[model samples]
Target: MKIRHLRNATALLTLGEHRLLIDPMLARPGSIPGFKFFGGGRRPNPLVPLPPDTFSWLEEVTGVLVTHPHPDHLDTAGIRWIREHGLPVWTSRLDAPGLGKRGLTVHSLEDGALGMGVERIPVRHGRGLLAWLLGRVSSYYLAHPDEPSVYITSDAVLTEDLLEAVERLQPDVIIAPAGSANFGVGGDILFSVDELVTLVRRAPGGVVLNHLEALDHCPTTREGLRERMKAEGLLEKVLIPADGEELHFARPERARGPAAPGPGATQERERASLASGM
Candidate 1:
C-alpha cells in the first residue's frame, strides 16, 4: 500500500486496486475564506498552496473518500474536480446525500462495501457546542487483501470510542489530522499536542499526520509536533510529511487476520441517524 501525503488532510491512498483520493482540499492559497472564525488573529485559509505536482498526481485518482464536507476537506475546486472525473466517493451516510447533490458519484462506506474489509468509525470534531455545530464526522479503516490495514481518523477530538477503535482495529498505518484546529473561543477542536502524543503511543504501527501550517484555526506547527514526538520517543513511528512529500510502506503479504468489526459503532450511528430522521 502507498500513502502519498499530498497536503493538509489530503492524501492519495493506493491500496490494492484502489487509488482513493482522501479529502481533496484543492483550493489555491488564499482562495477560500479563513477558518478561524472566532480567532482574533485569523488569516486567509490554506496558508500555502498545493505542491507543484498536485495537479499531475490528481490524475491518478480512481475514487474519492471524504471524511467530512468541511470546505477544507472538500472545497469548491475539489468538488468540481471529482465531478469531472466522475469518480466514486466512499464516505459515511451523513455526507452521502449532500455530496450526491453536488453531482458526485456517491457510495456509502459501510463495512465490507466494495469487498474491502471496511469499518466506519464515528469521530467528534470538537467538544460541547462546537462539536454540535460541526455535527458528526467519520473515520475509516480499510483492509484490502493486497495491502496493509489503514485507519483514517478524520478530524476528531479524542474520545473513548476513538481510543477503543485504535485498540480494537490494530491498523498497520494510521492517517490522522494533526492541525490542532480551534476557533479562538473553543478549546482545541482537533487533536491537541498531548492528545496526539497519546494517540501515537497507543497506535499499533506508523502514524502519518497532516493538516498543519495551512489554515488559521490550526495552530499546531510541524516542527513543534516533530520535537514533541522526538521527545516522547515516537518520531520513528510518525511521518510528518511536507505538502508534497510521499511515504511508501510495504504491503503486508499476510491478509488473513480478521479485521476488527465496527458493527457496534455502525449500529449506534444508524440509530442516531434514524432518530433524527436523516
Candidate 2:
C-alpha cells in the first residue's frame, strides 16, 4: 500500500485498486477561521497551502473516506471537489445520513464494503464537555486481502478503548493525528506528544503520523515529534511524513494468517463491551 500525505489529515491512500482520499480539507491557506480560541498563536486555519503537485495526485482518487463532518476534515472546497467528480463517499453510520442529505452518493462503511474487512472503532475527539460538543468520531480498521492491514485513528485523544483496539487489531500500519491540537483552552483535542510516543511503542507494525504543522491549532511539529520519538528509541517504527511525501509498505508474511471469524466481530465486541461498561 502507498500513502501520500497531503496537508493535515488529508492523504491519498493507495490500497489495492482503490485510491481512497482520506479527509480532504481542500482550502486555500487562511480561508477558514482560526481554531485556537484562547492563548496566543491564534490564526486562520490551514496555515499552509497544498503542495504544488497536490492536484495531480488528487486526480487519481477513486473514492472519499470521511471520518467526520468537521470543516477541517471536509471543508467547502473539498465538498465542491467531490461533487464535481461525483465520487462515492464512504463514511460511518452516524454520518451517512447527513452526507447523503448534501447530495453525494454516501455509503456506510461497514464490513466488506470495498472487498476489505472493515471495523469501526469509536474514538473520543476530546474530553469532558469539549468531547461531547465534538460529537462522535470513529477510527477504522481496513484489511485488504493481499495487503497489510491499516488502522486509522482519526482525530482523537488517548483512551483505553483506543489502546484496546491497537492490541486487538494489531494493524500493520497505523495512521493517526499527531498535531496535539487544542482550542487554547480545552486542553488537547488530539493526541499529545507523550501519548503519541506510547502509541508508537504499542503498535506492532509501522505507524504514520499526520495532522502536523498545517493548521493553526495544531502545535506539534514534525521536528519536535521526531526528536521525542528518537529519544524514546521509537523513530524507526514511526513515520512523520512531510506534506506530499509518499511511503510504501509491503504486507508482512505474518499478516497473511487465516482470517478472523467475522469481518468486524472483534470491533463489534469491543464496542459492545464499552457500551456495557465492561
lDDT by residue for model 2 over 1-278, one digit each (tens)?
88888889999998899999999999999999999988988899889988777877789999999999999999999999999999999999999999998888999998888888899999999999999999999899998887778899999999999999888887878999999999998789999999998898888777899999998899999999999999999988888887777777776654353234111111100111212221
Work out the TM-score per prediction.
0.91, 0.92
lDDT, each prediction: 0.82, 0.86
lDDT of 2: 0.86
Error of 2 at 112 (Å): 0.5
Error of 2 at 93 (Å): 0.9
**For every candidate, C-alpha RMSD to the true structure in Å:** 9.4, 9.0
- Per-residue alpha-carbon lDDT of model 1 for 6-121, expressed as tens digits? 67898898877788899999988888888777738788878888777677777888899999999999999999999888899988998899989988889999867867888898
Q: List the residue pairs that clash in candidate 1.
A: none
How displaced is residue 138 in candidate 2, in Å?
A: 1.1
Q: Which run of 10 residues does model 1 get worst, by summed lDDT? A: 263-272
